[model samples]
Target: MSDYVTYDESDHVVTLTLNAPEKRNAISTFADCDAVVEAVRRVNRDRGVRAVILTGAGTAFCAGGDLKAMRDRKGIIEGSHADLRENYRRGVQAMANALYECDAPTIAAVNGPAIGLGLDVACMCDIRIASEKARFAESFIKVGIVPGDGGAWLLPRVVGMSMACELSFTGDQIDAATAKEIRLVSRVVPHDELLPAARALAARIAANPPEMVRMTKRLLREGQHMRLSSLLEISAAYQALAHSTEDHKEAVSAMLEKREPRFTGR
Candidate 1:
């Protein structure tokens, strides 16, 4: 219910837009990331929401964690209240984990600047599509702090260790085209068409069976680290699970009939 975060649904896609554009969509001192977790949870289990697209309102997608908020957190740490800092740390990590574990397909439509915590959020998503106006940076080094949330873990996996090191160490921003070239984002569209493109992609994903889609995402994330033989074993188990769904029967029947299968996600 944060005024800073707006949630809406179109067809089967749920969109969460960072609504605080006036401060360059900075998710600072306010409870912005916590609000995001709630919104995503609301959409995650909702049968009507088969896919999700995350973006920012106004100019920049997010200027990263509100610097002012970080300052306040530093003040708390300096106060020698160890318990308080630990509790706050858990809250922040929860927000990052929510973005990572969201069951449906998650897309970050980076319509503008993404710095610090903003980069964490974008990397947590399953896919990223940026606008030509988008600018990306891992700004922790510039502020003389390590990435407080999940950036340390996610960046290296998205980009290789060497490239991730360079970005985090320098804190220089990269343009959308460069982001795509580095595989930080999958595609870059014009600013005006960013949301439209994201929504179109969401629709295409939502057209598939929800059960299979969820399993496919789970398989990719959980299976990435396993050996080839392990993956083959797990993949067969996944296919067995997929075969139990009514959507699978419909797909087979439709193939036999030479028609498109309309999956109900049941």
Candidate 2:
């Protein structure tokens, strides 16, 4: 964790908050990207961390890249054309990959605007719960650029190809209700309830067997790019591993005893 991203954990859930409120929590530099990636890596390294919630401080979940930085060619965008390409590859793209490959289940608490890279990052999560104040846009086109952080691949998978195309092509903003209608976000709550809702969801996920949850998330990620037959084989292997965990036996015993299960993430 650093100045850009704040990390907090409790009850097997880690929350990473984008902290640059004055710039609307925009990721302005390579260091900002590193902070996010590090936070995710921290979550993955902790076996007790069963879930993650990504949100932002103040308002605006994230306003994407800083406009001033882009205009001035400072920070992440500072360099020649070739340098810019490398910057993106090592900067935002790295952050995106880290989040996408995170072992624990991730939930985005979209408290406000999630534009361009912000929207894309939210999509990287397994679940997104938005505040009524939340707004979203795949607006890279507005800046005469493309999604250098994998939005093209991530967006379509979340909202379908046609809607993704429309959003990217037009650079238009959609409110929380519209996002929910298009299946972009799973739930929308009042602004004050956003964090609570996300935390509740994370708690529910964390209450389950931790290893099984991580394996299930891995299987889901693999299924995205794998053939069904291949996925079945991998799932079978995971099922074998799952059945061997003490948590699994505890779950079975708890069920048979007709009592609430207490998972130690064993």
Candidate 3:
């Protein structure tokens, strides 16, 4: 964790921080996008990591990609559609899949500015907590691009379709209070409390039955596009799987004994 980013874990919670604050922690290039996907995979793979919190090291979560970097690639229209699709498709899919398929609960602790793709990264998480000082935007249109990460899909799902459209079309920035009001963010606290609160939430989730949590997360993600009858079938299958876990027996026993359950994640 030599600080292009750092992942620190304790008490079954892992915190990932974007370390390049000098550029406002902007993920300016394809490599930065790749780094994010890699980071997500690494954090999710740690067997002991039950939950995760993501934030930036200095003043901002991310200001979006660097304009100078974007300028350099403005003339690049030489590739075939298939090549472009395959190249970016893999990278974006890796990022979206990392979050969508992650077994543990993930939270974005927004320290300050979040814009464009930065906001998409926030949307990837299960929960988003922002500092009162934080500002957010969907600035893709401002830069003459569509939201390339999960924004077009995720933003509308999180907020309403109209609101997502407005944000994307207008590229308007919103303060933390407005973001919370619009349900873009779940909570807002003092800047110093952002990481602490995210950690606390993650720890609370981590303390639950890990196997059940992972299964539930998977079901919820899959159920979004599934028909009601199909979802019911999936739920039953997962319920059967859950009932076989040793942790499930412990949960039942603890309830019978009126005691807190100690889950082994088995």
Candidate 4:
């Protein structure tokens, strides 16, 4: 919606690109936060969208907060202590919620450095694909601030508590290889091949029945905080709904006929 973020859709995949290349795609202003949340909302409600990819426009995937803004007390940084807490709630935190709650599977194609809030943004995605030039850090500490955008919760879930603690405490940037080794990114490709790799994975995910894909993602998200018994109940309900869809019937019929399934996302 804003110049801070741009949206594109093709072949059942929606791509949301952070557009402020001059700022290294920083989520500094309210418009930046709103643009991301709006884009995620759009993709979530579009049943035709089976998957989504998030990336940046230029060299850096996202450099996180605009240090200039912080120094000048402009953008999100311009506020009293209570005002700043509220700003986090309605701004960056809301963006994180929109992303994590999105129905379509999300892949973050980290083209370059993803620091602080940017790193947290990548962690919010279900999958991460990084460029060879990509780097990552839970860098809030470096700025004498903590993760105000839910990084404390999201990062630990992504890279595990010990590794997350190490990154957050030190605010050290890690190479793409180290990110992959720590499970921060599922794949690392050449800088030029980043988007293609992410799209290929998205296409693979999109080939499935769309409703099933969404429901499966929902189940996975629920399982993260749910007990085994509660998750099983939720899974059973979702399975019933999935089994009753026309796409499920088509899938089975196509298998029986030895043909590729054509799903209508019913």
Candidate 5:
């Protein structure tokens, strides 16, 4: 994994921290994207990891792409037009896809600014919790570009098309309160409480059977794009598989015995 991202695991929850605070944790190069992708893949491979919290190392969560790199045509931004397109596919786009496809449910703990690609990355998570100091903006337009990191698809799904259009068109930054009002974040907490809140949430999710949580997340993702009937069929299959697990039997027995379930993730 690249040094730009740090991975920590505890109590079945994995925390992925963007480590570069000097540039406000901006994803500056293809290596940065690879770091994020590898972290997500690592979590997916570990069945014991029931939840993931994504946050940054210092004040800012992520300030989006490195502006200096963009201006100087350096890092991922350095290339011909065709080369740039390919770069995106291998870099930011790959990171986005990895997060979206991650088996463990992801919670983006937005500690500060989430601008342009940063906002898109937050949207890629299954849930977002923001700090009071957090700010969000669909700011690619301000940089004379569109949402090349899948913001166009993600923002609309998270905040509705009209709100996405307004944010994308204006490129105006919204404080945590406004972000919560528009459903960009599920909730907002004090700056110091951000990580704690995220961990608490992740812990709640991790308390359940790990396999069930993964299947449930998969079902939710599929439901977003599948027909209701098709989703029901898939759900039925998942339910049948779930019923066959040792954890499922333990859960049912615990309910009858009036005790907490001891799930083995079977």
Candidate 6:
């Protein structure tokens, strides 16, 4: 993508790094959001990509919107009321939609402060792994603005409604330890080990059958909003497709032979 974001793929895993350390990798302008959306689209289209790891370049996972850009009315914060609504829908909202719907399993490696939209970004991922230095906040209300980037919907689903409301109302920053306590992050590692931990997790996921991994993630996403009966129906449909993959046959044979499975993304 652009210099704002960097994309790299290796060993069935794709890494999308927010590259703007000068702004703490802020999802500031439409271009920044576009970069994220494009990266998500790229990995989702690549069947070989079994997992994705999203993290920031420097110390901050993301600092949310650029305060300078907002103050100058130069980015998403610019435009009239109606125009701004459309801007958000097309810009940040679109980015969220892309990541949330991406079929590949995603892990957010929260390296540092993930505030405002940054927190929402982590919630969008399938799992979140944070550094001990990492901090999080749903601080939109502190700036007298709502979560224009879907945080209201994403955060509650993550930490539950009571915790979500408390964070949104207080606009307070919680450390990585507190985040883990509330189930915001699944794991917290030393600052230096953050990326390594995330990659290790990604590698474990990448070792599975690629098609089954993607389909399983889709089933889980759909289950979040569907009835139990509906989810079971969808699950059955997905399982049938999974059962037909060549990789599935290989996996069964490997188990029977007591050998590691070799999957060719079938």
For model 2, the stretches where C-alpha displacement exceeds 4 angstroms are: none
Residue-by-residue lDDT tens digits, candidate 5, 1-266: 47999999999899999999999999989999999999988997888898999998888999999999999999899879999999999999999999999999999999999989999999999999999999999999998998999999999999999999999999999999999999999999998899999999999998888899999999999988899999999999999999999999998899999999888898
- How far in Å is the alpha carbon of 97 misplaced in model 5? 0.3
User: Model 3: per-residue lDDT, tens digit, 65-150?
Assistant: 67776666421212467765664666555666676566777899999999997898888888999999999999999989887677
- Cα deviation of 185, candidate 1, in Å: 0.6
How does residue 55 of candidate 1 score in lDDT?
Answer: 93
Model 6, TM vs. native? 0.98
Q: Which runs of model 3 end up more than 4 angstroms from their true locations?
A: 1-3, 74-87, 90-93
lDDT of 6 by residue, 1-266 (tens): 36787999989889999999988999878899899899988887788898999999888999998888888988887889998999999899999999999889999999999999999999999999999999999999988899988999999999999999999999999999999999999989999999889899999999999888888888888888899999999888888888898999999999999999999987
Pitting candidate 3 against candidate 4, the one with the higher lDDT is 4
Return whichever of 3 and 5 wins on TM-score: 5
Better of 1 and 6 by TM-score: 6
Clash total of candidate 2 = 0
Candidate 5 wrongly placed segments (more than 4 Å): none
Clashes per candidate (backbone, < 3 Å):
1, 0, 0, 0, 0, 0
lDDT of 2 by residue, 213-246 (tens): 9999999899989999999999999999988889
Alpha carbon RMSD to native, model 3: 2.4
Report the candidate with higher lDDT, 2 versus 3.
2
Provide the lowest-lDDT 10-residue window in model 2. Answer: 1-10
**In candidate 4, what are the lDDT values of residues 39-111, reduced to their tens digit?**
9888877889999999999989999999999999988887799998888888899999999888899999999
For residue 171, model 2's alpha carbon misses the true position, in angstroms, by 0.7
- Global local distance difference test of model 5: 0.94
List of clashing residue pairs for candidate 1 = 28-66
